[model samples]
Target chain A: MSAPFTDAQLAAFLTGTLEDETLIDAIEAAINADPALATRAEALASAEPMDASVREAFAPVLDAPVPERLIAAATPRAAEVVDLAAARAAKSAAPLPTPANDTGRSSWRWPQFGAMAASLALGVLIGGPLLKGGGAGAPEGGSLVLASADLTAMLDSAPSGQKTDLAALGEGEVVLTFRNADGLLCRQFLIEGKGGTTSDALACAGGNGTGWQIEAYGRRAAPVGEMKLAGGDAAPAVVAAVDAMIDSDPLTGADEIAELGKK
Target chain B: MNPDDTTRQALIALIPRLRRFARVLTGSIADADDVVQAALEKAMVNLEQYQPGTRLDSWVFRIARNHWVDDRRRAHNRMGHDDIGEMLDLAGDDGVAVVEASAEARMVRAAVDSLPPEQRDVVALVMLEELTYREAADMLGLPIGTVMSRLSRAKAALAKRIAAEGTVQ
Candidate 1:
């Protein structure tokens, strides 16, 4: 006998905001009696905000690599500490002669002092030597840069979670594969060369089939007595970079293989 | 470990969620990133004011919401613009599998975007961000009844728009 419920009332009811019990009962009775009203109410209930499609649209961003600037902003001012630790470790390894004039190589025993001098001298030349020559295939400046062809093959065809034989192509091993925040396929790899030096690098698929772009690269600081190789666990810096960019969990083994096969 | 470090770690873990919420609020990727960055800087500056043993996510979300509201006010003053609907489109360059899916997603975003700013904020807080009604009200400094009313209206408006667009069954 009561007037039929309006769409706004029904919506409020669906959200549990409607308070009048008698009116609520009437609306319920009307919904049960009229199939049209029931269908409308069902649709209204299902189309809530943050629906599946909306969430799906954002999946790539959720899995995206966090931007480096954001990471830098969030990271504590501890790089100096890390550098000191590295220097101390380096110093204790070998006995060095004290400096004669208190200005030159004698102060090199202090890692910070030596590093400052080295930086001032090689500030411009630093990034140059770090760059590797094209197709020379040698690890340069402690980190290994993957060749375009090999990097492409690994990103396109290599299954994640399983180590692939990258030895034939280079001195590195593919540790894992994941999708960055932008939905680009990314792989984390470790390369070891002479003198127990190791490097961790993250590469993502370039746009328009340009092959992989190395996003982040860093040397794995060896412990005082032992060198750590890239394995199931990535270096802390590499992990931080990954954490910044990853919006979701890395793909499962089956999912990674299937995704690789798609390309 | 320093308390700041712990809070910083927790904040870092919440970045993805914050980014998603920012995307919804700003309705533009570039704007969302800027808002997030600004909120982060503000939070870091006021880190000492944050109460320990409380929900850091909610705290930071409030900061983000405040920053967004302030940014909108500034934009409104500078541009003398009231057209907030233009930025609602969230379609990205990533290739979705099916065209139909993409269209439906766009429709959903547009529907949410069409709501009035206050209503949209409530929807973003309660529905999209999965905050409880009380939490949303607390974040928005509104009464519980007001939050529910706004949400109801938002849901109704969205349903009507979606139905009218023929994007949903």
Candidate 2:
């Protein structure tokens, strides 16, 4: 605040970093004598000030309860220890030695080849699955192969309310769900456009499908009770709900086969 | 409790705070969660290397910072520009606390959200968390002068951005 106090001292004072008692008194004394200095000091406090409302906007995240799944996920298990060791050993095998002091290896020359090889390896590792029609990683549990003629006919029918809404859509897809080995429902879908502007959900239990009421007029992912529609055709949200319902055990083969006819 | 169990419990307890820091850093809850999960996994695997008396929160946060920085670098390398615009848009024009926001408040929030990552991170650590310069420097692995310069530039930039928004309003 004082004319003699440097901007550094003033900044330190504004940030609550000035710890010396003598310096604090001198700064205050200088600020009191010159109203302009007081104004300058005050300006420092308000400069780049945080808005109260921005803090309020994020306050909920600061207070929201941590999900149980996240808690379970955070806990380290013996399996992770095993995985970590294996990963470390895999890494150590290369060692990236100090080039052995030019033992027929130019540091600069080898680096370029090494990088090219790594990139090629990465490309192949990622591209191999995509080229195979759908990777094995594609959610497999929720796929319900429906053989019902009535349901198949409805999908291709012109007047069965199955026509996709093009106006309200930018990019969207319909999700299909079915049980998997883990008993969790998985989902897949055909996205119409770039950003899922017109997507369909094929869930049967909770989330966006079951727990919340789906409007009667909105396009549904698959047929429901008393409506014989496609099996394994639901939204990802619906699939999540179905997965949540079957937590511990896989849905039996007979029950899944029966769903194709009833729904 | 076994050391493994104790360490797990402590790490779990830090998740909320880690998430808060991550939200400040990434400006998106989904991104923040991803950062937190990645940081937690790294911390668990490297638990043996962590000194018992040191602050676990700071250690984990360092990992989060590194992970996000690496992600930013990779994204820049691949896309040639930060594609976080989609993430910012995902929260929607109407945030969850709309009832409390007036037109002016909304403008301020938008301005904060629009800040560049470098400036945004300083505000998150120094202003929001109130960390000392030395502590922040250590956390970010930067010199104290570098931290001050970054914070100073950030403040100046925020002033210009806010003034511009006020003029528009």
Candidate 3:
């Protein structure tokens, strides 16, 4: 008990890192012979500080079979190394980076360009069919005919749920009809281009129907199953736009036909 | 066995220990796997650079620490905060463990988890991993005295917290 060993000395002695053999022997003898030294030495043991609770808390991690994902990561693979933090962030946010939302370049000239629309500056590589111009093509990807007279004509003429193929804009269909804030008639439309490329747009035009401007435009992969556009789902962004602009419950049946018929 | 196969086997054998160590670094079971995966991938990529005859576990431990540190930094830089609560994986196993640890281990884990990252890491390396002071210093790139002080401080803090919790109960 007179062995005057500090906690550090006791720790070092317990770990067998003490260079002084004589002192080590003396401490071991004293610890074995003296109850107090034995108690302090026992507490200084590496496993002692960790205690039984920590052992229980940690033992399952050791006993549980290694997850398959972990085993795959350990094996040296040639590619598909993910950025762990970025992956975690993405996982926290939403769905995996599927080509569904790959058309990140906003073909829409967003009016007022508020916070939600500003999230369109994505680094996703644009893919899918070109915006085939009335001529040959606009570009392979990323560029589309945002606004045009042909689109305006389609907007004025196309009946709801009926597909209208425009010279500039691909096969387009008006899904629903409503009035914009200015009482100008607004039409929500879906256009499908080649290679599974799809655009959902809402446009407002006046009586002459010559001045069609897109109020909201969103690009997403066509939904699974049949490609019907009447009373169907739309991307949240496009839905939000319709929610913001619609001044009345959507026109239905003969009323919608009468509105389009006026043009 | 070929050296490559041998190395792979050794790395595989160390997974459980690595996993245990990772759980200490990240409180959640899932985040620990993320850290472990990133570290192992990095180790495999740089396998030739790993000096043979040296401790494979320690080398991978260093890699794991680096990966976790880099992940935290990237998360902080992107989010403008260091909380990293959202960055961590969902603690599905933790809920089950908490139900199990309702006896007393819950308080122990809470105390351990509450320790600062540096001290907590020290505790993991010394108390859990059972590294000597010199080995931990070498792996962490910290001085031996710093390792000793941190480990000692962590031990004292855990003891104090557990004792205080016992009194309250």
Candidate 4:
């Protein structure tokens, strides 16, 4: 039997749009009976292309610190509010209206950007999240994180196993220490924010004292409908980045102190 | 919240997904953000046309797709923009086999990039964006059959190209 099914028919089968009942049944039967045909069917099914990686293809962008300019552009002013510039100015200055009330959802308050980071918006269209002094900032833009003085000091003196509950920034714990290829020291840390917001972060020494460049950060998955942009896939992305830079076993006690002192 | 505020919050939430779609359309992260920025500005200008309670992502995606065609998608062969290949490593850090798969995914993306503009639009809208043929046709102002034809042809071409890549490696 010459089973001459056109690509459209197969695609329709994949998309569940094939109109003919007989052909649909036949294709389903064939797909069930033949493994090779099934594989080809999935590939041709463009609705979810690339082995169903459609949802994941550009996921990195989802976690990249949103450009503030784009945020301004996306915000729509009221009917009488014709002054877009003024609207954007107001939007950025004030925290966005509070997220879900009393339901105990993740409180991702729109963080205020430090003045220096705000100025960078003009020149950089794809800059990382310019976190305020106390928020858990995203770690992407130019691969540089703006750490607060306290955070930097902690990175400098905090022990590998110690956890510090910081106000507004969340509870931070230094997980381990390692040396990058530059022979400079790096440390992996975890931040557990109030209401269950968790960040697994890595920072390396260098980029000037107190710069404490955040190499990568991952938020533990928050529930999807919480109005927060959770980079659920970030943990692996951060781990992969650290793995590339990781050389010797993580430092302990005295060894960690020696590395920290040099930084 | 007021309507404008509601719309603002909703749009903010979608920023990530919109940026993701823009990346798919533009390939490079830099270029993709440019498209997203343009699309957002355009979307805000035409805000009244947006119907609340409808799919905001779809509406903005329509806007973004239109803007992509009119503006930067055709911007001089995408020079100076960061190469998207570096950003395509969404596949997790496994061993060598995972890296190879990611490399192949990049090759597939390149193949998609090489497709003719019209076919590329059909693929982006129907296949990658998961829009229905009717929706895609409406957005492109073409007949559903035309969208289907383009999709079929594009799928065949991608299959052929991907097979070649698999063998080459």
Residues B1-169, model 1: lDDT tens digits: 7998888888777777777777777766555666676677557646777999988989989998898897787553221121222222232333545455556666777676667788878777777676766678688887554565566666667777878987654
| Residue pairs whose backbone atoms clash in candidate 3 | none
lDDT of 4 by residue, A147-227 (tens): 455466678889876777555566667776888777768887766656455556677876466456666555444422333
The residue pairs found clashing in candidate 4 are: A46-B127
Worst 10 residues of 4 chain A by lDDT: A121-130
Question: What's the DockQ for every one of the candidates?
Answer: 0.09, 0.11, 0.14, 0.14
Q: Is model 3 an incorrect, acceptable, medium or high docking prediction?
A: incorrect
Query: What DockQ score does model 4 reach against the true complex?
Result: 0.14
Candidate 3, B57-89: lDDT as tens digits: 999998988877876775632212111122222
**Better candidate number, 1 or 4, judged by DockQ:** 4
**Deviation in Å, model 4, residue A100 alpha carbon:** 50
lDDT of 4 by residue, B90-143 (tens): 323457875666565566676776677787777677666677766777778875
Per candidate, the number of residue pairs that clash is 12, 24, 0, 1
How good is the docking of model 2, as DockQ?
Answer: 0.11
Give candidate 2's error at residue A175 in angstroms.
27
DockQ of 1: 0.09
- Cα lDDT computed for each candidate against the true fold: 0.57, 0.48, 0.59, 0.59
Instruction: State the lDDT of candidate 3 residue by residue for A1-263, as single tens digits.
Output: 63598999988765445667577666656664666765676566565635455565466567667876567656533222232223234433433233444344433232333323322221011122322211011111112223444555667776776777654345777877888767878887776654445666666773454455554455653442442332323433344455556676568678887876764
Candidate topping TM-score: 1
TM-score of chain B of each: 0.85, 0.75, 0.81, 0.81
Candidate 3 chain B minimal-lDDT segment of 10 residues? B79-88
